[model samples]
Target: MFDLDLWREIFQSINKNKTRALLSGFTVAFAIMLFTILFGIANGLENTFEKFFIRTAENAITVRFGTTSKPYKGLKIGRQVRPSNKDLDYLEKEFGEDIQYMSPKISRNYQVSYKKQKGGYTVTGVAPDYQYIEKAEIKNGRFLSLKDVNNKEKICVIGRLVEEDLYLKESAVGKYIDLEGVQYKVVGVYSDGGGDSQERVIYLPYTTIQRLYLGKDDIGDISLTYNPNLTVDQALALVEEMTIKLKNRFDVAPNDQRGVRIGNQVLTAKKRLDNISSGLGALIPIIGFGTLIAGILGISNIMIFIVKERTKEIGIRKALGASPKSIVSIILLESILITTITGYLGLLIGVGILESIGSSLERYFITDPSVSSSLLFSATIVLIIAGTIAGFVPAKKASKIKPIIALRNG
Candidate 1:
């Protein structure tokens, strides 16, 4: 029930010992503020790490062949193993359902030109799906399509750097650029935000490069992004199976590490993500609970002092027939009020600080340092509960005070 008289008496008690109450309130405020800041920082760090994985598919695996380390079938060691379009076809035919996106790429530096403007840039032969694998953001026009690859169309996607150098202020799309004296119509301009080096490349259909430029079916590397539903363990197992199959197909030893190397970013990304999760999970509770204990202790100690100071008053009330429940409720309500007010203020301040600086930290990849609304609500509830528990002992002692003994002590 609402009681104005009780509230007035509580305010009077606070005014009487302002410094003690202030100090107790400060403890609660500091603890909550510290917890909020730490939670923001932890989330920021996690966000920063996540950006590294965004450049490529989170569950991608790149396959590259190297020289054999072990001799097989009386063949000498150090035989170089390389993948071809036939191997790509075999894999696709065998495991079509397991693949999300797959690309067989071959890259070479060529003299690229538009009129008199000429620069040596890496031209990569890629399938339509390679655009998705690279996460290339199309600034203008469209990426390579299946029709372009199937018909071996002389179409290419130029990077932002290429567009700037060759086309200048003009649109590169629908313009023809010469790559090694062969004209390819520019279909798209793309960017990866990976800096100038990444932007100095051009992409063309793999078939066109195979038939016209390279005059071979050999691929430098094969990259594949698997189904999103597959776990890291499942992806790794698929990679192992692919490695064994490829090794057998190419006459490489089964246990030769150098023969077929599958670089699975899925495993790496998963491990890093797990580390971040474990770190934040363990750290937040320790710091938050430690601060909680400190605040509770501070409030408990001050409540004991308040009880001792009110001994004579409590004795007078008891002699006037005041109930023990009412005495306990008074102390508990005071504790809860102090904690709730201070804790809410602390949360507000902490969130404000994070929002103010969040944008500035984007260069460091720490974007949106924040806590959930549910978390804040939960903290408020915890504060009130802790306050109630802290006040209970002091309130019980005050209620037990005998009129004669309390008056004598006072």
Candidate 2:
């Protein structure tokens, strides 16, 4: 089956029209190469986006309440809605076992100072659970404790960017910073590697943020996390039940009057991210296939021309007793060989480019742009199959050629 003469003939035929063969090979290579790069970029973009979101916590959820689009009851659409500490406590008691951590955040724009240095900031009030739920890492000192929250202690944590701007060094920990003219001790610092530049936030005990700054016990919203023991769907289902119960406890009516609002970033943002990733995974392949189809067409056109030129040669062989299977196999094998080599070369080039440019690409995008090994293997198989298909019609024509007619044409 592995005849040296057969391969020799193929080599000779390709050598006869070197430029044509080279151009055909290049077409296949270019298609595959372009496809690979696009796929790699898609992957890199997804990875970067996922990483940033991960720092905010994968399992955690965020809640926000604002004016609804439609009027509820007799109230206008712009009616303000707010939550309270009692609502947070109720939710915690109800879903504590199903959660990893919880926090209620209230944000305000204010100025902070340490010594003579001052920095403007967005201040947030959060419980100790904020650290776990936000995946926070303290660069120095410690986080807020229950004592801080219950006693309404005037202690705060600073963002990395804020620290550099106000302290000039990380040694600002254990020192007091004036927030809104009220002195609060700096307890810790966290990085803003999520690409938000940290927003210069000064986090304090939820109670301190409530009483001293906002002048109210009302909160913005609560953040919660569900246990990994359940599936995402299951966890979300339990949370939804708890959400309804908490809404009831807060005396939220059917139209949401006198009620607190709830929300989840894990359910909304994370779910959207999942949909985007899946869509890209499906879309990039379609693009690659379009390129492959073009390459297949080119290979097929050249094969047809090759058949036309070699009609007499093929007829003579048939007349001399070469079987139809042999003729078909020879042509198909030639196409397969060409497509495979060039496709592989294209894949290698694409991978090389991705390796060199992937990091920069990652910074620009939310996912990776490179294909997996299994995908490469699958693509190789597809290339070979495409080559065989391209050669089939010409091979069939050659097989059916009449010796007498072909001889006259020759």
Candidate 3:
């Protein structure tokens, strides 16, 4: 039941003790404000981690060759260990079930000209599966096809920035672009999540690059995506197994780390995410305890003091036939009203600050730093409940004191 008279009494009491009420409210508001901002920053850090990893396919792995550091099978140290088209075929044949997509990469820097515009760009030759391995989105036309590689067709797929740089407003698809003296037809225009650097290059058939530049079936590197159904452990194991086999095939020592460098995106992302989660787990409790506990304790102490200060008033009300329940209700209601209003004010200020500084914090790897609506709602409820309990103990004690004793103490 809504009691107007009781509410009036609460307001009158609060008006008489404005400084005490304000102090109590400030303690809770500060606590809630600190809580909201810390959580927002944590969420921002997590967003940054996710965005960084999501640029490439999670199951993707790359194998690059380097000079052998150890000798094996009479092959001296410092011999270059080069991966070739044969290596790509061997992996497909050996781990066909575990592999989803595979590609051989051959990269070179070339001066490209379209009409009158000329620019220096990296031309990477790759198989059709490179599209999925690189997570490229074809905005128009199609990516490299199997026919292009099989026939050694002089065709290329240009990135979004490539189109913008040389072609201007014109689309690059189906147009012939001069790479040095050789002209290659652009078959597709694609975009990448890895920013402008990734989108500034051109893609061609790996076979064409091998034939034109190397005059042999050599490749720069091998990229492949493991089966999506494989667990993180399984994917990592497959990479390790593949590395060992490749090292053995090249007559490199088993412990030669530099000879065969295999990088697993899945493993890297997992480790990073695990580290982030562990950090957040440790940070939350410290923030909660430091802020919330202090607020709770502050409010609790203040409520007890308020009851002690009003001992004479409580005694007078009791003498005037006021019930114990009525006395408790006034104090509890006053506490709840103050906590609810101040808590919400603190929440609003915290969220506003996050939204305002969100863009600037991107340089620090902090993305959208704000709390969810549901969490805000929960915090408000918690503050109200905390306020009620803080008030109840002191209110109950004050109600129990005899009128004569309260009068004497006052």
lDDT of 1 by residue, 73-129 (tens): 998999988778888889998778888999988889999999988999999999989
User: What's model 2's overall lDDT?
Assistant: 0.76
Measured with C-alpha atoms, the lDDT of residue 94 in candidate 1 is 74
How well does each candidate superpose onto the true structure, as a TM-score? 0.81, 0.64, 0.84
Candidates 1 and 3 compared by TM-score, better number:
3
Which candidate number would show the highest TM-score if scored against the true structure? Answer: 3
Instruction: Kindly indicate the candidate among 1 and 2 with the higher TM-score.
Output: 1
Locate the minimum summed-lDDT window of 10 residues in model 3. Answer: 265-274
* Segments of candidate 3 deviating more than 4 angstroms: 1-6, 51-55, 67-70, 76-80, 96-100, 145-154, 181-183, 211-216, 226-237, 255-258, 264-273, 352-368, 400-406
Q: Which 10 consecutive positions of candidate 1 have the poorest summed lDDT? A: 264-273
lDDT of 2 by residue, 120-231 (tens): 7888899999888776778888888999999999889888788888889558788888887898888888865555545367789989978886788988878877786766
- The TM-score of predicted model 2 comes to 0.64
Candidate number achieving the greatest lDDT relative to the actual structure: 3
- The pairs that clash in candidate 3 are none
Compared with the true structure, the alpha-carbon lDDT of candidate 1 equals 0.84
